[model samples]
Target: MSSEHFDVVVVGAGLSGIGAGYHLQTLCPDRSYVILEGRAQLGGTWDLFRYPGIRSDSDMYTLGYSFKPWTQAKAIADGPAILDYVTQTARENGIDRHIRYRQHVKSAAWSTDEARWTVQAEGPDGPVSYTCSFLFMCSGYYNYAAGHTPEFAGAADFGGRIVHPQHWPSDLDYAGKRVVVIGSGATAVTLVPELAKSAAHVTMLQRSPTYVVSRPSEDRFANWLRAKLPAKAAYGITRWKNVLFSMFFFNLARRKPEKVKERLLAMVRVHLGPDYDVGTHFTPRYNPWDQRLCLVPDADLFDALKSGAAEVVTDRIAHFTPGGILLEGGRELAADVVVTATGLELQLLSDVAFEVDGVPVDLASTYNYKGMMYSGVPNLAHSFGYTNASWTLKADLTCFYVCRLLNTLQKRGLRQTTPRIGAEALKPQPFLDFTSGYVTRAMEKFPKQGHRWPWKLYQNYAQDLVTLKYGSVDIEMEFSNPVPTHAQKRATADA
Candidate 1:
């Protein structure tokens, strides 16, 4: 029944939470905060998912934080490397001490009377409470403990071991074995080539296709800088350069779909051949950047397909059999193992319900303030990464904005902050406005963005550098509620 409190309580000790803690400490050195990590370790996505061939889908140069330089030899970093980088950032910045590992936040409810969030959590020891003025959720959408495994007609009937890449079993070996990877997203694509390296045969099963483009492991200038310049400085420069490049390409593909289509098709034509039906197998019927583009590491995947080590089956998986999976088209793909690389399942707002004055807030009916902030939700800001450019680009911006809001709170004697965007800012969120399953799933719950190119999570560092990073926090923020007293009983006590 004991309880403690902090100025801020951040859920998820991943890159986003770390960044938030770091910025908060920097902006308000006097303030104290605690980071609650569900796992025993720090890094969220980076530390989790130990599947084979785990690597950054995006280039590391931009994926890394803005303040902390990515001093890695490879621009496209693997999971372990990314995990190490985040751990090092935590340690070097002295943020590790603020993190409480294995503290699984089950739910968080806000108290309008006290102006504090009652975070209820369950750990190895059982239920606990931690109250804070500000609650920042940096947990990435996908549920780590469980990934999506669409109920196949007979998944239990599968005699052979089946695994989802999001939760790959380490003891399960696939060397010299036939493996079938289901789904066509990044997970399936990466698993196809990676398993083929060891497995006797690997087949990528998908209902539809994505425009997969091969990229060099290292760009020429990026390589030159790594060899010639100081590590941190070179990393910063390369990070910005890659960020700009990514923004350019993403905008190019979105604005001029035909150009990207031609470029993408040409690559596929050279590899798959004219008779292979690039329109069906290679081309995405939707425009480029419609969904998050899948990155192919240095044509490794293409080379694997070409080497005859792997094959792609463009048909929906019907069900699971004892031995393998059967496609809806009556094509039964037999294998020793089946890896469900299907899409991720997203949970918004940390599955926490919000209420103002005891009235439950239906997020589906509510509007998103900024890409991160929600309306009337005081002392709360969610982390949103970039679909284009790097994930950290938007993460860093959100962190910066949080810090700015904090400074404003102190200056103006404000107790709570929430975006007051009314009917004027009902535009779609940039990059996200596009039709992506992840975005579409949470559109109603998330904030409304402007139609303008950069304001919509458009990945424009130059624009965000001005708006979010440096924009003034000159708005109406409520400073109600007196500080809690000893006689004050715990309100909704439990993370």
Candidate 2:
């Protein structure tokens, strides 16, 4: 098949991809681009997961793109609502036309001689190829095909329906049934309150505790700002407000973990009441910010607990009985349905194979540059968001920087830009410092970060804003023009 050529190729049509497309069009208007989406539809994460009570853990102000305003009433929105927002953005901006759905990129090979990337993808028809001057990977960090579901001793013995949040069955009925959700992370927390509404009873079973915080469902301040000011201005002000608040809390958590732990537990205690055993369920052994804090809007989980519709069981599972899970102490909890909201399976670069000049790129050996690009990768950028703040906050900055880099390349007549590690004896650290199960499981599969500037992945959005937006690009980056091809040289000589 003939290869379709473009100036840029963006993988994934989700939040980051749409944002990247917008910036590329606005900042580098002369360049042509295409968005390759693996799924038939848009909204990557929001469209994939169909579990009950699926919503954003972070607020919408910062989660929404910098150029767009999230005017919805609820800051923490549901899956359908978030998906609609993303779809509307693409439609309204005319970005939907550039999207090629069901195009799953299998591999990308970079040619230094041509200063281009030849990407191979499997589309609905068959094998397809595309060449582009720059590649942008916006595919998220998690695997869409499956979630992290550990094998229980007798999972097959249970007659009840077992479901993983990643691949939730659309027709599976859980209404008026006793549902047991395993795990205590965001998914588990989200499903418990939602399932409790109609289920006869919902129980969250966790081996250990996670720090959970209660936040308001609606942002009164943001609403007020939208009411008084222009849409763009209101969005800007609310975005900054959220950024500052998130940064302050994250800094406080790291600086004074004990104090932050106390404050978080106190909030939980207030929501659950003094009679509730907050220590056993809400208190975590590790310090605050070691893992992400689960956000429960309006204390919905606590409200369910108070209403006797849900309960928390903290204990190790011995095995699965015919009717329910058997705890270590031989106590059996009745369960008509089991929801494994264990965690996500992290897959970087969409697990797409990469090669540079016939040499395979070993992602593990390289270091991350500015948390977006790899040390040895040229003319490529990946969208990885802040673990602490809303994803779009970092995504916006990364896309903006990529646009700037593309414009610089065009103006300078350069064909390639790659980050080369310096001679400094820098200590290498894991890319992400979180202790979450999903992150820990996939830590070795990703690249490491240096202890110093430029190579380090700072989780701080404020620091990233100054560095990515205003920082010098030539600090560790190398730019060059590829040697002219034979045809080009012959044409020049003939002219």
Q: Judged by lDDT, which candidate is best?
A: 2
- The residue-by-residue lDDT of candidate 1 on 1-495, one tens digit each, is 777999889888998999888888988787789999999999899888788888888887778887887765577778899999999999999999999988888867777658778888888889989988888889876667777777789888988888888778879999999998888888777788889999999998877888888777666677788789887888778877887777788778878999988898898778766666677666677877887778887888888888999988888778888888888899889899989887676677666766654677665554454567765677787887766667787888888888777777777786777655544455554325667555575556554555642224445666777877666564433445456544465543531
Q: Which ranges of candidate 1 are over 4 A from the true structure?
A: 271-277, 423-431, 438-459, 475-495
Best-matching candidate per TM-score: 2
- List runs of model 2 lying over 4 Å from the truth: 485-495
Find the 10 residues in a row with the least total lDDT in model 1.
449-458
**TM-scores of all candidate predictions against the true structure:** 0.91, 0.98
Residue 257's C-alpha lDDT in candidate 1?
92
Candidate 2 whole-model C-alpha lDDT, 0 to 1: 0.93
Model 2: how far residue 346 lies from native, Å: 0.2
- Candidate 2 worst ten-residue window by lDDT: 419-428
